[model samples]
Target: MKVFTYSEARQKLSTVLDLARSEEVIIKRRGGEVFKVMFKKATPSSPFDVPGVKTNATTKDILDAVHDSRARKLGI
Candidate 1:
């Protein structure tokens, strides 16, 4: 990830876009605080593979698993 100031991104919009299409770039303010701009690799199934998400478990499934685990641990 690369951080670029607002002015730099504004002046080099084309280059920024090109870089963003290939890699992640962070656009920030003068104070070094980032407000916007996130980049990701180009892919077709990008939406399917998400981090920290369990596609196989629903709310009820999670509750059931928790209940089972708790019962086993507590002997209840």
Candidate 2:
């Protein structure tokens, strides 16, 4: 993913920090759109890859699945 444009990433900001350490630089602008620059993907902390936080469903399992989908759409 290498798009760049904002004046070619401000005139090659050090080759976009060395292609954002591996890959992912987008940037755009001279017309608008495009983005990504990197970083932001560090959450998973156990329960084997976070299967919905290893199935624990709290907050009363999201208000019991929003009160059982508003009591099955009112048909209680």
Candidate 3:
């Protein structure tokens, strides 16, 4: 863990963040306030990736339903 005064942290903000990646970082204020820095790693995923809904419909059934809907919409 590393502790730095507010002024020191401001001067070495980059270093403070780098150290926070692997450990804890604390910043102290003259008025007796303290703050902790944490690095939150985000997980990578595709925007199209999502949980699927369980249904009894098959691929062919879904296609047929779409075609029927379009045909009605176009007055075909």
Collision count for each candidate, in order:
0, 0, 0
Which candidate leads in lDDT? 3
Q: Which residue pairs show collisions in model 2?
A: none
What would the per-residue lDDT of candidate 3 be over residues 1-76, giving only the tens digit for each residue?
9999999999999999999999999999999999999998765598876678999999999999999999999999
lDDT of 2 by residue, 2-45 (tens): 88888889899898867877898989896688777875667878
lDDT of 1 at 65: 95
Question: What is the per-residue lDDT of model 1 for residues 12-75, given as tens digits with 9 covering 90 to 100?
Answer: 9888888877678889887768855556555657777765754888899989999999999999
Candidate 3, superposed: residue stretches over 4 Å from native = 43-76
Which runs of model 1 end up more than 4 angstroms from their true locations? Answer: 39-76
Q: Rate the local accuracy (lDDT) of all candidates.
A: 0.80, 0.83, 0.96
Clashes of 2: 0
TM-score for each prediction? 0.43, 0.26, 0.57
Sort by lDDT, best first.
3, 2, 1
Comparing candidate 1 with candidate 2, which one achieves the higher lDDT? 2
Q: How far is 49's C-alpha from truth in model 1 (Å)?
A: 25
**All-Cα superposition RMSD per candidate:** 11.1, 13.0, 8.4
In candidate 3, what residue range of length 10 has the lowest lDDT sum?
Answer: 42-51
